[model samples]
Target: MYKFLLFLTASALPGVAAAQSADSDPAEAALAEIVERQDAARQPVELPDGRATQPVTLDAATITVTATGLGTTIQSTGQAVVVIDRKEIEQVQGADITRVLQRTPGLSLSRNGGAGSFTGVNLRGANAEQLLVLVDGVRVADPASPSGGFDFGNLLTGTVGKLDLLRGSNSTIWGSDAIGGVLDIATCGGSGVQGSFEYGARDTRFAQAAGGLETGALALGLTGSWFATDGFSAAANGTEPDGFEQFALGGSVFADVTDQLEVFAHANWSEGTLDIDGFAAPSFTLGDTAETQDTRRLWGDVGFAYYGNDLTLRAAYSMADTERDNFDPAAGSAPTFASDGHSERVQLRGEYRVLGGLSVAFGGEREWTAYSTSFNAREETGISGAYVQLGWVMGRLAAHIGSRIDDHDIFGTKTSFGADVSYGLGSDWRVRASVGEGFKAPTLFQLLSDFGNPRLRPEESTSFDIGIEQGQRGRGTHLALTAFRRDSADLIAFVSCFGATGGLCTDRPFGTYANTASARAQGIEAEAGIAVAEGFRLSAVYSLIDAEDRISGNELARRPRHSATLFADYEAAFGLRLGADLRLVSDSFDNAANSIRLDNYAVFDLRAAMPVSDVFEVFGRVENLFAENYQTAAGYASPGRGAFIGVRAAM
Candidate 1:
């Protein structure tokens, strides 16, 4: 692996040397090229110092592809969404994606321990399992998990270039597990070669490289990354140190078959090994133990697109496979626990213009999911869905109405409906509203496991939101406020049968899954950005969420009621950039009973970067500047003060 990485780095040295000998600064030139690409996609936002910057909030010119499953400007869609480009991503100066994502409104995250631990992301007060996550346009959820949710712990920001987060339910377009929202991640793309190397606290080492080539009718790209760290103890009271290591590779190919047709393919693979603490013998309490986990994931998709004067067609086949194994050194050399999950999907979609300013979108999809565990046999299920939508754009008004019908092999049939409208109040102001329905079928483990209940019902929800925006991006100031509410029914929950003799414990003496819970989540999201002065900018995001269980009337676990972030960036002399950010999270319960209370905490971070030469730049960051001790989970310990430095090169 090291040799291959060296080879990749050496292949790009010639280009770097050539750029270095140029008259212009290579760093500045690279920044200019990135800005030019962003401008071509959306309206360019500039700082008071005449430097280009990505906006913190969605503006009229911002385009979103996740909202409607098609490229549409924010002004034409009623759904609340946020977009983060590469420039903003690099500003964070970290591999952990959760660190940057938490700055967005209506989003929160909880990790079991430091990096490489199990991480969960919650949006708009909804559970992590209730949302959908897509990477490179492929669903990466693990079907073998209890809730079939995506884990963010292993997701590093190495190759990611863009992220679009749509904050509302829209199962009418995307089938299952979209009750909360959708997170769409796209990998880096462009005709360039870039790489970075870093060394940080805890003996951490990181390296990443990406290169892309664009010819007349063909475009290709490749990316690779490696990370290793001697992490701190996971248990709050443990003394032993844990560790983690990971390697990832990705590639993409796109070719123009004809003037109006194109084909593309993308693939990514990753493997990681992590040392974890688990329950010990005798006391059976959570603490330091000689246990470790190994995980491997592969995701890929092949698709084609055809463009005509007034019609567009697309088709794709995607697949994702995940395997996990847990080992205990005390037990034996063999893995104590093992599981694997696989998902395959085929989809075809098209859009046709019915008349002026009017168009219709329709699509159909078939999916198959299967899972196997050490103790349980392989189980599989299939689902098929079809949807149609009508969009109208007239003058300053835009509206979309859509519906979908899905048939599950075991759950029978389900239908969903959604509608949204947006109207421009003026050139710099707009108002929007939307209503949608969502549903998620039970996972294979929930229905086929030893403690599973075959009579479980699918979870369903109804959501509504309205919002208003004022001021245009790069125009000195921008602000947006949105309020949303969602009601869920038939939520799946586990029921323990420790002492029960009858009922759900007749045959299974451990536990059984059932749909005996309901919930309601309502909240307000506010965002603001201002050019404080020349060479400086300030942005703030706040969220007030009230998420509760209807049955117990208690706030959901790990869902903070009030969260806010304040960020500032300044461009100083000699092409130097400095940044600081503060994050505040209110206290919340750690369990359904609301007995374990997690304390509120605030964290601060500082970062800076300076150009060393035309082809290389140096950057450093201090995490947890105040060294404030805090914990997001009851038994897990969050990282304290840590410092890291890295160098980046582009050609």
Candidate 2:
């Protein structure tokens, strides 16, 4: 039936020639028909497993909002960007978002243990703290964390419907904490109800429900998910098993008050409880302990938009709150440690087309952040920023230039500039280049905690990239290659005050944060996709990176020099789908000292699905098919081979 569906899809193309025409090549014509349909509908055809048979492409019709703070086609933006839609998310079939993200180029992951553990995603070998994350347009970074970074541990994929990853520095448009890149995530939306449930290895259970309503003047959506697992030991040599549980809920609403005006609001909340292993007494070594960490996060935003013939305006207010608590059975019944953080932001932005091929985009924003720990008093700071961008598009060439200025309550003022150009050689080829500047202010915790440094300077960085692409991804044969480099200075690092009696350590005996480090990262990324046959496809992504510290000349921790992913999928005529993927990583150090090494490893996964009816489908997958034993971090044992089965329903 797969071929019959393809035939029906091809026949629906409005202006395309028939696939079976004697004057046309059947394979080429069929692929062209698929691409046309994808572009016209803005949605790809789904396979039995709810995955798109063909990957989404960055054609003129495909627009990305993350690249320029406004909708822009990838063909017009020089920045490296990747997009994943809901269909692709279901293809991975797991709660862990990292699994689906790993397939993207120039990206890698490091987790402390199994699912729900502290996980970090590194882009182009940049520090995890340098990347900015947004959920439904709300910044969710933890202000109380040492580096003010978002932890991916509790970020499940159940409610996420789309993701846009813009790689490289983009401070001119996004302001601070965008030194590495930006990740924009949108929640599920539509006019129907859908749900899924699965039970897997390690006694794991996962469930999700989402529903939406759409009318001529209004739209509403709500989503909820739950996850629980009896996980394996976090410590490699430990005996006892660790467990984790999480709950999440989100809602959104949009109303058209007039023909040219709209109002919208979004809210999300999540809570997680994770059993963790810590240094045990007596030996003071890494071991299993009766310890657990609880985290709760809440974020929301409300906004309005106005549209005109040649102008658009938007205004928004957003807020985020985070609370964390740690407990140890041996310590006491109450929590042993706790922290709270909060952020509020207000912004106004607008864009206008000055000419048929020229436009101007501008925005201004103000943010206030506060944090408090059990041992410290509440502290707060504020920052305000403004930016402007000029975009020009003439025929096959497109370019953008932008600048920004930010005033920090404690750090004074700073300026950033960026530029990019993209030129299309033909319908099947394109070349692009870009350069950007980035800066990040010190976090509240880094400046006000017991180990804080009141005189710390902001971290700064410069990034550049050049690339060439042939053909669109998942259309016939496609290939892309890119070279990138980034240099960072005044990087924050912890400084030990042991036995010191002078300088900044005169009154401090433990440790303090300071801007005393520099680093450089360079890498090359390559990606290829082939439509090998009518119902089969293959894709691969690879990256070579060299990340080093300028002061110590040592390789940065937990960054592998080489990494690659290979994936293949096939759809049979019997309404059955099969897929497999393999991931490979080279050896890397687990510490800044470069003494401990994590061994090189490879992991494989297999999955299959079949539709039982028009509304329900069954699926299963086996992860770590070979049961490979490896670690992404020292002392942390990764999950072994596991199997899971599930059913999905849609209306």
Best by TM-score: 1
Put down candidate 1 lDDT per residue, 1-651, tens digits, no spaces.
Answer: 763673467335322211211112221222233223323444344434565533333322255667877656666688898877666778888788988897789998888887899999999988899889998779999999989899999989877766779998888988889899999887766667887777898888777777778787887888787888899999988888888888888888878799768788989999999999988988888799989999999999999877665667778999999999999989999999999999999998877766655779889999999999999899999999999999986555679999999999988899999999987675467899999998888999999899888888889999999999876432468889999999999999999998989876999899899999999999999999899888899998999999999999999999999999999999886779899999999999999999999999999999998777887778899999999888888899888899999887778
Error of 2 at 71 (Å): 1.7
Q: Runs in model 2 with CA error above 4 Å?
A: 1-61
Per-residue lDDT of candidate 2, residues 1-651 (tens digit): 322332232222222111111112111122233333323433343434454423334322144567887556667688888777676677778898987888888888899888889999999888898999999778999998889998999899878877778889999999999998999887776656677777899998787777667677787888778888999999998988899988888898878799768788999999899999999889988889999999999999999877655677778999999999999999998899999999999998877777755779899999999998888899999999999999876556679999999999988898989999987675468899999999999998788788888888889999999999887555578788999999999999999999877876876789888999999999999989898888898999999999999999999999999999998888888778899989999999999999999999999999987777776678899999999999999999999999999877766
Worst 10 residues of 2 by lDDT: 16-25
RMSD of 1: 5.7
Error of 1 at 323 (Å): 0.3
Q: What are the TM-scores, per candidate, against the unseen true structure?
A: 0.92, 0.91
